[model samples]
Target: MDVTGLIPDFGNLAFTIVAFVVALSIIVFIHEYGHYIVGRWTGIKADVFSIGIGPVLLKRMDKHGTQWQIAAFPVGGYVKFRGDANAASAGVDEGAIAGLTPEERRATMPGAPVWARALTVAAGPVFNFVLSVIIFFGMAYYQGIATDPLTVKQMAPISGVENTLEPGDEILSIAGLPTPELAEFGAYVETLPDESPLDYTVLRDGAEVTVTTLHPYPAFVGSVTPQTAAADAGLERGDLILAVNGARTATFEDLRAFVGAGDGEPLTLTINRGGEEMDVELTPRRMDLPLPDGGFETRWLIGIGGGLIFEPATRAPSVGEAFTGGVEHVRYIITSSLSGLWHMITGAISSCNLRGPIGIAETSGAAASQGVPDFIWFIAVLSTAVGLLNLFPIPVLDGGHLVFHAYEAVVGRPPSDRAMRVLLAAGLAVVLAIMVLGITNDLFCP
Candidate 1:
């Protein structure tokens, strides 16, 4: 390991903080705007429209008597009804607009017609979903989707890979795993050992053929940065990271998270190049990466990108199928996200992939650097995730509120206040549990 690497420059922490705040604020605004516009349409008086939590930062009163303000906790914001003590804590008046008659209170939230109330609550999440679709279509109409072709990008002169799996052969599946796209196929290939035999089924000239071949990964035999320790383990270009310790890997991110704080000793890697899975070992070297507080912390670096090369940078999606591709891309991503969450629960997928605001901020900065097309794509992905997450059946969220509204519609009236309180409590617990799990995943995985 070269121990003489230079320090990392996050460039500036203030810039990152500002960027994160802006991104989150925009998302929140769109989400809340959806509810506000719909509520107004339903003739419900919104007494307060707040950005953030805790205390008020700034305030302005509209002609409708609604006070629009930015709050102290900037992380969350809400809309308060005429009679609401708070948005989530509606119906319980501790002194705010107390002593009003049922008619007056009805002007508030509790007295509103059931359908009106439900629609108002549903607008927040609906807005989120709309925002996602917009982002998806916009990004797609701008940058064309990535297409995975059946043709070979490279071939081995002596090993005869072209002989086994010819160019223009449409990939069907690996073993039983379906290869729907190039990204999925890439994951499958990366999961294989560098030179190990892999079963691949492809459609070529109206014929299906199964072939065995090797997948190559780049190893760091050398590094300009002293901290990339993957080089020290005798790993070099053409070596693949098939498995970590004993766990199978399918993506670059997986390999990274799985190997964080990597045992500190010589860790083994399975690499395949010319139809062979070879065992290699290496120790990581530590170097500093930029942190949030205008400082740096030492972390391990591998000094290598990966196998199955990245395509050259492109500008935008094609004029023809860009929108179609974009929509399909968003749909597929949303479905995979739900499945991924389910798998996390079942232990088939690791929860370490759950990223909080901190992680999102870091990624946002990276996407920005990549260019507008990539950044827009990132927004679409994240917006879709946030939209789905809000739809989870947990109280304190729009989805949970929708469930209550649905039940009230079925049973003829709203749930009891006590019941609502209990449900909110339960919902709060679920939120906390998810937060704890995500934080734990971050702390332990790396």
Candidate 2:
């Protein structure tokens, strides 16, 4: 056996496990704390608040008589309220509540008002959403929004192209075409001719000047999506695509056209990274991309985003603007997630899109390897997904518990203990089946 060959694989596995645990632990803590705090506020006492399941590794008693603990497994967490049957809070602990007085009974989860119980169960998903919003808001505030008029902040170096644009130069026109508003620049770029060394008219030092430079939208790699062909091929930011299978690529549109034409065939990409050239072979992946007008389009993509030849100058956005952007980001994720799930269910998209624990761990490792900013962004995205998933109306989940609460509210009593047990068991089976399907896809899907 060649033991040395397995060393790199083992190291990568370890890194992925650590990254996955770290990300999952943070999200789970936030979710479980939401239940704990809200339960406390509603006069329901949480007997145990554990960040993980299985045998306890660390434990502490808080002043409120709640035992805060960390367990062996780091996969998930839960809050066990007073007089609950178990961590899932499926039913009341009849033996524990048998001797309690009226005042003490009010502290148990089952003894609380229907509204209080509902709020406590609903808080977990709500907190996950709040964490995502906070992360998005902080990122937006830190990055700042692009300034209007598309002024150049810094030029990205391209190996074989001459860049005459300078910082603070407000772009006025490109190749004799008047520049459009910043919001319309992307669509405007598509209308430009696919050629390099174009005429760039800019406002330099309060005077209009004409300079020759590479096309505004060149074959430059701005970002790479994790767990995709480009990332797997070791593509990095700022790498310029010089050619595709001996065909020259001057603009990003040319590169896109080449990839789209490939139809998932393997291509030889001539790349320029920091003045050095190399060849990379990768096959484009077929993807179902969501469109702006609430539909999806199929495309072959290598999973890299292109950008202009220079970084645009930016301005600090107002607090309200940043917060609004954060909210919109969350909303978009929620909507797109729902749409994707529906498409998968309806056979409009591939079921392979449903990723399991392994897929998420791989993505976690990839994101961490990219850098802290990318890792944080991945966490925000995963948090949104986690929040959305928990809201599904399935048993053994927060949403299922909310439904039970609703039933109790209308019937003036909770479901029978036997019926509750059966429904919860059925929900557990549905959840496990989904998990199995996801894992199967992770193992078998491309």
Cand. 2 Cα-lDDT: 0.89
Q: Write the per-residue lDDT of candidate 1 for residues 249-367, one digit (tens) a residue.
A: 54455566655657455566665545577776666544334333433345555555554322212346654565565567667766767666665677654566576665566556545
lDDT scores in order: 0.63, 0.89
lDDT of 1 at 122: 81
Q: Give the per-residue lDDT of model 2 (tens digit) for 61-127.
A: 9999999999999999999999999999987789989989999999999889999999999999999
Candidate 2 segments whose C-alpha is farther than 4 A from its true place: 1-8, 157-163, 205-210
Candidate 1 stretches with Cα past 4 Å from truth are: 1-12, 94-107, 144-326
Task: Assess candidate 1 and give its lDDT.
Answer: 0.63
